[model samples]
Target chain A: MIKKSLGIALFTACFLFALCVGPALSADSVKIGILGPFSGSLAFNASEMKKGMLLALEEVNDAGGLFGRQVELVYGDTECKPDKGVGAVKKLLTRDEVLVVGGGYCSSVNIAASQIADMEKCPVVVAIAISPTITNRGLEYVFRTSPNSPMFLNGINQWLEKVKQAKTVAFFMENSDYGRDGEKIWSELSKKIKAKELAHLYFEIGDTDFTTQISKLKNLNPDVTFNIASTTEAALIQKQAKELNFVTQWIGVGGQFTEAYFKMTGPISQYAMGSSLEPTLNMKSPETAAFVEAYRTAYPDSRPGIFSSQGYDNLKVILDAVQRAGEPTGDLQQDREKIKDALEKTDMKLTQGRITFEDDGQVHSVVPSVVQVQLENCEPELRIIYPEDRATADYQAPQPWRERECQ
Target chain B: MDSLFLQQVVNGLIIGSVYSLIAIGLTMIFGVMRISNFAHGDYAMVGAYVAVFVMMWLPGPLGWVNALLAAAVIVAVAGVVSELLIFRPLLDRRTDIDMIMVSIGLFILLENLAQFFFEARPRMLADPFGGNTVDLGLVSTSQLRLFCLAFSCVAIAGLQVFLNRSKTGIAIRATSQNSRAARLMGIDINRIYTLTFGLGSAMAGIGGVLYGTLFAVYPTMGAIPTLKAFVVTILGGMGNIRGAIFGGFILGVAETLGGSYLAMEYKNAIGFVIIILVLLIRPQGLFGQREGV
Candidate 1:
């Protein structure tokens, strides 16, 4: 009886192992790794990033192939958590044997994953995570295609200093590296506008309630509330703020400009301004317009937003670097080094803007846009409100809940 | 400052009522089934999804009422099905670890399924109240929130009456006290257990609709609420109905007040700390009885 049971256990163990380690990946394809929260709360954004990368990939493969070998992607779902980010990166580097990695969506996830990629000598071209610490560590392999935290709010800063001129500010930041970095940068920028800091509150990533913090803000009633949250959290915070009768001009720094935000909040999102790497409605360049057209054609149900643009640019930059670096030598270390060197020397005009990384791996040439949700033909629309040259609409002052005509 | 204090108190009680509603469901499941159902919170997620689905067909004030009823009934049916298909087989098993592992597996499965069907995007129920606020001097809140609080109170009261006055409620109570003795005494314990599971899930579903009304609903919305429910269950004493209610309210008020007066960062931590102190000081829980006494 004991021997039979032991034999059954051994069979079950072998079956499980076979299930886990599926068919081996062919060695012919050039593998690139992608890290994002593909399954958790941020899955929609991650899917957008993935779609962008896939669009870029489709263009290259359609033209023929990259260096006579088809480029394939290996995805690592970080679920926007730091510990999972570490594990996913380790798996991609060691198990998948990817040449280069791209598409780090969340700042905290990117920060954790970048460390492992650097340690493993794999080049990571970050797509959207804006925390400066990812590149400030001076890691040899870490590079950012998107602007850092300070550079991300250029348009917003210009608007605050020139147009709005707010005096008092409050902060509702998510409790993470992203939020902490946002608080630091915004606090410093607040000094330029001479806005007194009224309150700074932190909420966790998955938090759905904000009444406790919003009530406190109601008492203080700052001129503007600078919020640092993803798409969903931003919607909830603004809705709850409205619900509690705490009205203010809400400024979302670098995260809340999305299709989901508009859908979730509707008219409650009116007058709420946010900073975006690329304007959602207005296409900056012919290249951007073409990319957007191609994206809409590919994904019929969904529209490409800032995240898709980031993903598309990141992949394009990587593929461009790979082309410049010539054919792979089959030597992983030497090829990775070649890609890193080629990336450092990159100077190209893509959809968003010119992609050029400084010594710190931060993009210097790209200028972000400030956008506000406004009433256009009885519907709330995101309009470019800053950088007078690119202004689609003038910046509107804060409107009280009852005074609003749009809803 | 006085108004702020009053505002915080009102917020705490309002949110506390939600905690009580969810914890009652958790306590009922534990009290009768003796299963540590980690997926109890997913019932709320399911409820929210159902309500959102119903509201699409039925819009306006009448739509919300229909949405709440549909969510409760649909989630209750789902609970019965889950108990029959999943938990019923495990009922004969002796080890406690299997039930825990299975419940956790259920939690992951349900979350993934919701994500697959509904997508991970956060959605809001169309507020029929149209952003109307109820102002009383300095304290103000949305009319929708007040409605949710009132609904929660009514539901809890109704459950209390059913458990005390109804025939099936007596059988459930009997089974909870001594399952083997109740079974010997001609009570169909399996049917009673299934009914109890359905009732508990219905309560969680109602909480879900109210919660989804106040906040955004998505695939993983139930995760935090479930964690809070567990904390409330332990604080009120495991398997104690009255204890869960008081425990939920205390936790909600303490967390809100602590977040307001102290640091917002420690809002969740305060509940855990209180639970720790409770464990060390009173292992049987604040309102729970010593076993076999």
Candidate 2:
């Protein structure tokens, strides 16, 4: 009876081992790491990012993957936290032993994770973290395909210079790396334009109440408010500002150029303009049109936004580099170095813009546009309103909240 | 500047009332059961999601009433089930720390479950009162906020009456005061516990719906309110209903006013600062009676 039981246990153990480990061992794929806030406050962004990444990976595999090996993705959930991001990058670089890592959503998380990649000597192609310090720090392995904070305001600067020229400006910023960098750059822009800098108010990242800050801003009552926040906080700020009947030409970073922002705020979102690297609705190039069509086919119910394009570009850049790097020489470090070298010399036209890295590892070819949320056929749609070539609609100077025609 | 100060005050009071509503629910659960239910805020998260689901079936202004009602009912039932499945089993064999740990585990589980079922995308509850503002002489506020304030007041007053005047309320108070004595007096301790949890959870649900209306709702939306609720409960004296109400208003006003006058970044820290001062000055809380008394 004991021998029979032992034999049964041995068979079950073998079955479990094969079930868990056999596939991993048998799969001859080049492992690449992708990091994002997979399961936290910013989990929605991660899902959108993943869809874009999967689309890219799918296309690559269909076209016969790099060096005849299928590309496998190892996802590390940063949860939008810096420490968590570092841990994820560490695990991806050390344990997963991925050839290269890509995709970072939060600037703070990306900044921390990039250091870990640099230390590990693995190339990390950042998809969408905009803090200038990310590339400005001069990290060799850290490369950002997305425009940095300094470049983000280029289109907005044009808008502010010509139309909707405001004399006074105030900042409603979150107290994070992203917010600080935005404040620094926009504050400089405000000074450059000879616009008087009014009260600059800051709030914590996850704070639900902005009434106090709004009240402070209302007292100063600047002509324009440069607000820096992610989707949730950004929506709340707008809603609260409207509740207080405080009206201003609210300009946001690329964070507001998402479908979720429009859906969350509804009609109140109308007239809010944001500077975006990729205006999803206003497809400027054939490359962008193709990518958007592919995205729509994959995600039938959803529209691809800024992060989606960034996610696609992140993977595509890595794949391009890998293709140039030639066959993996079996040494992990050597293969990683080869990819890093190729990544430095990358210059390709992507959906967002032409991707070309400067000496600082920052993308130099991104063309930004300012898009406004307008109610088109009773649906909130983002229409490009700046950089005249891409302007789908003229910039409409908004009426006060109480005066606006909203159903 | 004067109008701004008044606006800040009005905003504080309105927001404070919400704090009171959520804190009262948390205090009730603690008072009767001696369980520091860390999962209390997640009930509000559930309530918010429930309101979202119900609003889909019933849209428009009047639909908000139905949505709020649906949230309260569903979340109350969730509270009861949680009590039976988790707390009731641990009631006899566990320490306070164990109960707290379990509640925290339950909190994380509920949050993740919500995330799994409803993606982490922030959802808005349709405005019950179409975006309209009621103009006060000194300051103007939204009709929705005023409605939230009124609702919070009415709900709190009703709870006060239920506790002071109703038969079940008396039994609940008795159980809270001394569960063993109440049991000896032929009170069903188990029933009172279930009722308290349900009542507290219902208040949390209502608070959630109102809060969701004010701010967007998502999976982790409950964390801030839960932390604030804890601060209010502590400030009001844990398990003290009247104290929770007053504490909520004080904390709310204090935070807003402080945020206005002081640095905005330290606004949330105001709650913790109040906690420290309260702990140092009056450990029993503002209205908490002595242990033996």
Candidate 3:
């Protein structure tokens, strides 16, 4: 009689274990975690990205969903800080138990989030952070849908040589990881392009003034001033640069291609070419066209920019991987493994360009470009001027502030 | 001197004037009331946004005049409301920290409220002085900076004249000296408190309008100035009006030169380092003395 009771208890224990683990592995709703600075200083980019990602997500869910399960977006607000990002990602993985994660507008925040997601073995599809080292770390579970930071250097330097004839290059950078990366690349490549580089200028994030930096730059008088600052700082520098008359050919690097720069600087923003991961407004991918149209229709009060395109494409990459992984078979570990394997082999055409990954998980299909906002008939028109094939307008030789028509 | 050095000095003075305007208001408030009013910065931020909106609505050149006038009056009224509703009720607090905590709460409340209404994105007030510069022989300065300097000088002079010569000003100073004694001498301490707070807030409002005109106006615009005001107050001797003005110029010049010669990243450190050095020499600050002084 004692033996019979023991056998019955063991059987119940096995049943309870299965009951506990089953739903976690296979649920009717596929939980995908999205994170970024949804509030705070980066909110402008975050809002644009959220809108873009949501648009893609709705379309994906509407089209029979991923793996025949409904897609649900669970969000984590990182506030664009590294430590905050780690905490947010932890909750998303441990509490929400998200099967997939998508987001990253700041490089520092993304690097931190990816580390946490890596430990949990959760696949994170990166949207917009541009640090090259993020992919070079050899994390199998991490994939990026945006161009890396250094990718802009060669293109920018090439354009500088071919068009501008800038002999000396000056760098005004933010004192952060992405900005450091920019400084490193520009300094390294400037020698290759036979251009002399001046001492690197730096500013902390959120500083309103740049008079000192402007004074120094004007004194040194480099031919091309490469400003690797955030969107707000870029606006501040350009606005002050015009006032100070220090307008060497300004080549704005990452995170500066937002609408705010043009909106705030107005005519002063003219003739400044910026490196961007998003395809120009006239890029003819049917998916890009549809995304832009839908974004406009949905957010009439807002104008979508680079983050919007990156967010949409990042979602597409993640959803495609999930679709390949198929329905959860009540084994989360097994399904996660399948999703990782499927993400490795992901190859498709999406917004911006064709979407595919290299061995290091950097998206090889996304082509970065340089775009200029010109006044055509007294209205701002964005034009792509790089790589020639995608050229909507010929690259104009950059001139000093004294020569520009805007002055 | 080279143009760069000359340019930096001019830049320093321009920034100095704005700092002086903001710090004077903060020092005045702290002088009369023991409350730190940490939300002083947010008050400036609110004023800046109000100024921006006024400019947007008024159209063309009058927007500048209207923004400044409206911001000063509106923010002054808000200060009266803030004191009556917030500080007046908290007068019987258990400790000064409670009032500080309240001010901090006000800081967060005002910042978030501005964000909620204005959105987190920065709003730029169309500057009547943007893209224009004045030739000062050795170097040129932006018209915006010149305008800011000119406005601050007028405002500071006006405030000084009022404080020195007017009946209300004397009553305010008496309350600052001894609220209990002033109350016994037939001065309405609460009325003095209300007037002082309003005047201080009006100063912040003008500072805000000028700040918004020069730099971008956003919810967090006042944070740095507010912090710098603390430094300026401590450097000038807390609650000493003249010292705040002196500290503002000193801090601004030190920051600009330090940023130029030392490093831009450590620009903020320059002011603090000076503060540390100053405290070591004069515990009372450059102008600080006894409570009455």
Off-target runs (Cα >4 Å) in candidate 3 are A1-29, A62-70, A328-335, A398-403, B290-293
- Give the lowest summed-lDDT range of ten residues in model 1 chain B: B85-94
Instruction: Give each prediction's DockQ, rounded to 2 decimals.
Output: 0.54, 0.44, 0.27
Worst 10 residues of 2 chain A by lDDT: A17-26
Tell me the fnat of candidate 2: 0.72
User: Per-residue lDDT for A259-339 in model 1, tens only?
Assistant: 787788888888888887653564748788888889889988876788898899999999999889888988888899999
Q: In order, what lDDT does every prediction score?
A: 0.86, 0.87, 0.81
User: How does residue A308 of candidate 3 score in lDDT?
Assistant: 86
Residue A181, model 3: lDDT of 87
Better of 1 and 3 by DockQ: 1
TM-scores for all candidates: the values are: 0.95, 0.94, 0.91
Q: Where in model 2 is the C-alpha error above 4 Å? A: A1-27, A162-164, A279-282
lDDT tens digits by residue: candidate 1, B1-293: 59988898888888888988998998999999888899999999999999999999988889988988998899999999888767777788637898888788779878987987898878888886976888786898888888877878888889888888998888888988899999999999989988999999999998998888888889999998899999999999998888888888888888888999999988889899999999999877899998999
Better of 2 and 3 by lDDT: 2
Scored by Cα lDDT, where does model 1 land? 0.86
Which regions of candidate 1 are displaced past 4 Å? A1-25, A279-281
Query: Residue B186 error for model 1, in Å?
Result: 1.9
